[model samples]
Target: MEPLDSPAPRPLAHIPAIPIFDPLEFDRSLPSSQYTLIKTDDLRSMYREIGRVQAYLHNLINRGDDTPSLAIDDSKRAKTAAIERVPPEILSMIFEQAVPPQTDDENPRETHRLAEILLPGQICRLWREAAITTPSLWSSIYLKFSFPKNSVEKMVDIVTTCIARAKGYPLSICLWNQSDTELTQYRPIIAVLLAHSHQWDNVFIKCGGGPRKNPYEELQGAKGCLSMLRRLKVEYDEIEEGGSFDTFLISPKLRIVDLRNYGVQPWHEIGQFPLLPWRQLQQITFVGYIEDALELLRMSPILRVFKVSVVGHSVELYHVHHAFLLELSVESLVDGAASDLFGAFTLPALSSLSYAGEEFPRDAITSFVQRSNIEQSLHTFSLTLHERRDTLLIPSSNIIKCLESMPCLSQLSLHDLSKRYTDTGPFHSGDISSICERLEPRPILPKLKRFSITGPPQMSCVYLALMVKSRWRRAAGGLVWIESVEINHSRPCAHAKSSMTQIPAHIESRESGRALALLRLYRSEGLRVVGSLVDEDECIECIDEQGYGAFDPDEN
Candidate 1:
């Protein structure tokens, strides 16, 4: 059915009635005479054309007003061009001074935080390009990404950009991946980057202390990745479930290899690896091992610094068939089975030696020291007993003998790294005090520069005093002293305190009374102290938690 229209159009809500420009009446009606039409087209075309001419003149007047403003802008730009300009070389020098890249320890974890700080300062486009182009600046690369689940894409982008900027120069790559689950996912990206491993000069990879994957396979697959490698360090903890022993050997061009805390393969296989290629090898550190020294000796010809820490039950003979003109740390358990290990281990060129497990037989330590001394190149020597209590027990008198043996030692460090422990075997008390007594007749380290003693306060005090006296006697130069004393007043058997009773007698000596006063004041306060003394009498201001002491106006 068709709908019927309304009789008249209903007034629309939006429309307003003109009412002939209504003044008083709200709805004024227009007169019929005003509605008459004027036929302008029939009248004249010239008048209409004249109206167009007036509109053109109005636009020209407005454009003329804008011309002066444009001229003023041109004048301002000319003024800006008059300033001085800096050359590219000078700019590069400024950027290099402003942004220095971070180089980390043998392990990559140490430098990770530092790299983040330096990364942001390189925000300027020109500065960033300069930094990235500088091979030396970009040499140390830190690649760590396992943050959010969606970070892999961003990680790949950053790595690709860094690689492009590296421009084929040898790099120090530190890849710290914390997720084993993500490892397989990211393996392809790593393989692509590491395939350019030959571009690495000194690579240090410290995987996160989380589950790890077989990174060695990726490293091996990288074509010529280690060709330019000079030093390599791989430190992974047990937390990285997939970490393996041979991970440290990924780079064949490694000159210095440090394997710490990570799981590794058998010692025989490690020893069997050809040492002939590492002709330039100087240092090898194996902190935790399942094998003996004799087995590792197979790679000793070029070895300079060898450190191995094995448990008491697994002590094995660590002998040196060749003389090395550097440092050596070969130790075994103090049990009877360790005699052969100690006797057979001789370091003719050894300058530094540290024993951690137990004191070897007096005769064996003495013989080892005597042989080491005759070499005449020994410069630094150290002997430490790992476990001690209140008693000053000195298990290896040979330690004292070893001090006397190295007449040429320039630097000495004596340490008792052990904290309070229960007596399990033939134990002695007051070991720290006895150690101090043995160290009293300080071995004349003619070139001694640095000396540190870490243990209880009583022992540390005697040790430091004796060290000072020794230096006084020899008039050594450029001495750097470190005293790390733990203030624990819980143990009543304070032999270090009882033994220092004689200090009053020394204090009474008129020659050193002033120095004794300072020492006494420090002791009474029970404040842990560390600093250096220039002259015995002059108390040079030093730094501590209390802040640095300043020059006094009255004390000229």
Candidate 2:
């Protein structure tokens, strides 16, 4: 045997390589000596020597005395190639998607969106250039600050940097100041934003809980500063006796305004407030007295949408008709106040009307529809009635009369106003079935395509199927078919399961299975049926706000 410390043997260069034996005759032709030689201690020692040499070579390579392993070199090359392959345009698109979504109210210091936007720029030179040149990345600015003596200076610098980076692009600015300092603390930041008002597309300002002075008093003489402004939203915590918004009167391009007064004192009278370009305004949302809303409506000749929540009961208007108004939403008004308010306006072009409150004035709506030319022009209507102990009954005759008036109606939504999941109210299946029966005598809404019903489980699948059948025409092939039907009901409790499940179970098992059978048949023919049993703790926030708990058909 060789010495343990001796050098390992070298390969025999003189020997030619050849197979020791034919594997086909292995068992029969193999000798015992060949197996013994392979298992011997000499061969084992050679294998160990080979392993030690390989480890020593690896150590040398890692110590930077030799070239790196192929794997490491390949990874670095691949990274460089990938970065070079992506064009600037595609990189900009990816950056845009990574940008955070806009929020209505957000603290500036806590905003992670700004950090996300600035992170890519700090990664490397290539990414930094891509982020800087993308105008959309810097267009949205949210400035929220509290008084700390130095906060004003910091905010000014930040605002200036964002505007400079935005580079002539349109801006969407949201400013919120919850500081309790005097109004002067906010002047520098406000002045910086107003200096660039010509580039403002959408601006929201809310500064509350400060000194008694008005926060917007700094804009007293900044007329025509908002030359390119399109939408403005302002909410004030307090308003002095003579405070006015006359600064915005000269904004020729202003089209949308949302104003909220959260002050304890009464707002100045409509005539005493700032002058607006009423005819040019397209949409306005005001939360103030009914008289002020009426006065604004009287001056708005081409207004298309108006949403108002009234505080008083009476309204006076001299204009007999509004020619261009198409949508009107009345909220938080009593029956008498709603009637008086609706009586003052003749909306000739009104196509959609929404009323939300405890008491829905059906007679007042019917009278108004008849008086105006809405019977022929109205197409979409919604009524959300709040739950009350008095059990407000929606008269079937009134519903039928209202449906008869709107010949061009395409969509109808009926919903209970209570957003709580456990609410059960006065809506019943009989009322809906009666209205469906009225539609059967003659075609009331020939163009009606979508029907939504949301409340207690009073509406059965049978009445809903009948309503769909009445609107369907077999002979016409596919000329007329109800597009969608949505039904939302309270879930049955464990204790009351016997009562809720027994009726449907018995009918489905023994009695005529007309309801379930018809619903299945219609669904096979392209009618979408969405039935949901809501739990007391079910998530209502996930539901769509526009439709009455209806699932989007496209999602299916």
- Give the top-scoring candidate (lDDT): 2
Q: What global local distance difference test value does model 1 have?
A: 0.48
lDDT of 1 by residue, 391-471 (tens): 344353435555666666666666665533222221123334345444435444445555555554332243334434444
lDDT string, candidate 2, 1-556, tens digits: 4332224552332233333332434466445686655655465666567666666655653463245333334445645557756888888888766544433221111222366668878977888888888877777787665557677888788778878888887777776666554657777877887788788767677777444444566666456777776677777555444646566777788788786653334344422544567778888887876666777777777888898776656544454588888888887655466766777778888999887777767777887898887887898887776776765565556666767778778888877633223212222234343455455446667777888776544444444545677675331332255687766655442112232334343332211123434444566677776655212221222222312222112221
Per-prediction RMSD in angstroms? 19.9, 12.7
Worst 10 residues of 2 by lDDT: 103-112
Query: What TM-score quantifies how close candidate 1 is to the native fold?
Result: 0.56
Model 2 ranges off by over 4 Å: 1-91, 94-131, 209-213, 220-222, 236-244, 261-270, 315-320, 333-335, 388-391, 395-397, 417-442, 456-459, 473-480, 486-524, 527-556
Best by TM-score: 2
Considering summed lDDT, which 10 consecutive residues are worst modelled in model 1? 543-552
Work out how many backbone clashes candidate 1 has: 14
